[model samples]
Target: MGWCSCINLFPPSCQLSELKSTMYERQKKLFDSCQRASKVVAYRLKTPPYKLDALEPYMSQRTLELHWGGHHRQYLEYLNRALGKNDILYGCTIDELVKVTYNNGSPLPEFNNAAQ
Candidate 1:
């Protein structure tokens, strides 16, 4: 159960059990949706944030320096760290995490550190 359902449960006393049932259904729906989404974006190939040679002379052989040596390597590292737990996010997709944490918030604890 999630915080919402717990609140809707005993809080301010009880109602028809219908409220409880409804909250249960909602939480179930959310979990199902998360699961479905995770499956959808799983096992994708890693792509660098920038194009080869985009950085040019200053960063020459730059594609290899950053894309392969840095960005690609980091993706593999992050993948290992992120999958370490059968934690809440164990089944989550890389794309899903990227989409979810695109904004500032409490860091994902594992993924945020791995990505950096």
Candidate 2:
């Protein structure tokens, strides 16, 4: 079998561990970007969502300030807190996590928390 085939053979916890490591690396980059930014915060938007202009005339600059700044930023900050430790995800790549978790059909719980 090919090297990758072994991935499919791994048990759930092993797979989850692999996914965790991969996701951690990938998330590290995003985390680094956040650290570089003045606010040190990154964003994650839920759907049924659009850019400020998508709402157009109804969503004026003031609306964006309230929605993106107040609402969106709040979500990101809260998500960061839910992720708990900084070093956990900062060391792996998202692709690696995805590959290992592939056998599990879904990501590990930490993946959901961190990606969000």
Candidate 3:
């Protein structure tokens, strides 16, 4: 019923609190979307911008070769393969797939990299 009680100028503190609340809500939604994107998004092979030999003084090319060329590449291959079978989950974000496969807190038998 006061000056700011619903129809007039809101106090600075009240306005600030409202602004913070709005930002928090928006940020939370964004975070959730990112999480969901992980599953739905196809695995992309990413390499460092610098040449493999550039960091050789500290980082070895062999390490990069194995990590990027072998492990990471392998992971993507399997993820794609798995996605191929499940039309529903394939399009769904990783977050959704994980939740569905989680079986209401109980994980499915297939721990084949999908769980990770």
Give me the candidate number with maximum TM-score. 3
Looking at candidate 1, the ten consecutive residues that score lowest on lDDT are 36-45
Best by lDDT: 3
**Per-residue alpha-carbon lDDT of candidate 3 for residues 4-70, written as tens digits (9 for 90 to 100):** 4456566666787797676556534543554342344565676778887787767799988888788
State each candidate's clash count: 0, 9, 3
Candidate 2 residue spans exceeding 4 A from truth: 1-58, 91-116
lDDT of all predictions = 0.53, 0.52, 0.61
Error of 3 at 116 (Å): 6.6
Q: Candidate 3: where is the Cα deviation over 4 Å?
A: 1-41, 93-116
TM-score of each: 0.42, 0.33, 0.46
lDDT of 1 at 93: 56
Model 1 Cα lDDT, one tens digit per residue, 66-105: 6677876767666656656523345555655554444345
TM-score of 1: 0.42
Prediction 3 global C-alpha lDDT: 0.61
Q: Output the better candidate (1/2) by lDDT.
A: 1
